[model samples]
Target: MDGKNALCRKCQDRLWDTRIPASSCERCKSYVEAGGVCRFCKNGGMEHIVSTYAPFMYTGAARTLVMQLKFRDMDDGLAYLTDAMADALPVRDFDLIVPVPLHARRERPRGCNQAQLLAQGVGVRICVPVGNALMRFRATSPQSTLASLRARRSNVENAFALCGDADISGKKILLVDDVRTSGSTARACAKVLLQGGAREVHLLCACVVWHYKGNEKNGSVAGKNGAAAGQHGR
Candidate 1:
């Protein structure tokens, strides 16, 4: 298999075959495949937190494509991501489609937003890609570090702001990002959208850290190291 297919296969295998339970919530179950809200959140009865849908887990073939797309600036790598995002997320009839924005300093050098590229791919299926709906307030340290969840949340707090008069009042908004880590960035961005008068914020990504909680499938196996396995931004 080629690079992209190989990456996807790895993801497929983990989600399907070697699925593991989330460490926290024992009631919630997740596999590497796709679909459904996080079982952990559901079992915990957390209302604020919603299920994050991802087509692939953050490992294997998915990791390779993400890395190349961000580092090598490989258009083909991006092509794979876009197609998957579109297949995974169909944002049709939504009041608006918003992509998480990058800081201007970072964006200038990259010349493109990975989230926007994903949005464009999804838009081909739904016909709506809002590129300038939101903006990052400032640059912050990567979430991989920050020691604790609280620190991660603080790292992204007030990190995003609405740009222009894109009225989303009582309108459904789709928030797109390349990946979902601790969900801190997504939460922070959702706060901005809620404050901007959006009726609701739905989260979508190409991949997310597999936090399966405690389902039988999740506990059955171990997850491979996804660190240094993928890249984000630019």
Candidate 2:
């Protein structure tokens, strides 16, 4: 195995066109390869989350989709993203899937949470059951509004509570979200669920936000002609 690439000769040969995709390498360089944990989760330490996974880093096409979903009333965006996620994430053994609840204010218009849509998609694809295991007890500014990770943590702290009658004790839980930034929201929600008796909390998302400097060039993950995005498995 090439410690530099972390790929054995044969497997390296099997790697697609580029052989070593920058995102995969970067993921390893960050923390994904070290068991798919993020920097904030590793260094600062998440209170209860076990592992986190995403098909694409939040950049290029992934960023575009996220923007469309958040700002525009593009319901179809969820379907496309959900399709991509099915292939990116393995069919893991999770007892229940739970979506990170959106504040009622944000969820009212759509009548549902986007994270719920993502969670439902994951559930169907992975053949797991999904539950509304948590609710947003208090509304806070979006994590994106906060400038520092610490501030982001503070912003989301105490934002979530276990849903009434939801039993998570000893259950392997998959917490689904549309995107994971500093992971503050996921961590907070996981902490609550863990306290509520969840055995293990694993995070799954369609995309993940990591600091990247190359967007003008539209990174390789951006498909042909710099306008398309092909999720990892697709």
Candidate 3:
């Protein structure tokens, strides 16, 4: 395979080519159907997040990369993914980069937390400190296994707590994750960070589900909101 870094040139092209459209929700970056509603905004919780940024839509080669990193432990693509994520960041003043914590049970079996790996890559590229500030104290069903948004939220509600020795008072934090589906997990973590006295919480993910159907066609041209093959929203 002709490649630079871990991804082949073809795969890299396909990965960076999938960009979300400007028609996405201004708050959450979920695609807004023509004259249709954005489920992300409709469900609320945008207030808890300052903005969300992602390098690719969770589809095609992008999905494959995330899956390989998380499930297969093929982290070679971490450099490319985090480089894109760092470029996609809307602001540069973050005091810390914190990965969403995986419960001990899950992390032990998985052997690694994909989110933390991404966080470390992003922190290195952006020159920000990375911290394991949040702990997933409760083990909940995987959000992907849940059907409804309510159920997803319920599953993760109160699942995260701030690490006892972490001092986040008045500091802006960037939360890192592999993929953002319903966003229930991210919001849960952000809520804990905010309550724990973080001044602001922003999100940076490798990819975001462009639409609920997960079948949105890829666009050749980057959208107005697309921040270098990535999308960001306030």
Q: Which candidate tops TM-score? A: 3
TM-score per prediction, in order, is 0.73, 0.73, 0.84
How far off is residue 165 in model 2, in Å?
0.8
Best by lDDT: 3
The lDDT of model 2 is 0.63
Model 3, stretches more than 4 Å misplaced? Answer: 1-5, 33-39, 212-234
* lDDT of each candidate versus the true structure: 0.59, 0.63, 0.74
Q: Sort by TM-score, best first: what order?
A: 3, 1, 2
| Candidate achieving higher lDDT, 1 or 3 | 3
Cα lDDT of model 3 by residue, 67-152, tens digit:
77876756568777888888877677899999999999989977899899989988887899999999999988766555555676
lDDT of 3: 0.74
Per-residue lDDT of model 2, residues 99-133, tens digit only: 99989987887666778878887777779999999
Residue 35, candidate 2: C-alpha displacement in angstroms: 9.2
Can you tell me which runs of candidate 1 are displaced by over 4 Å? 1-51, 212-234
Q: How many backbone clashes does every candidate have?
A: 9, 0, 0
**What are the per-residue Cα lDDT tens digits for candidate 1 across 120-158?**
666666676465668897898866545444566678788
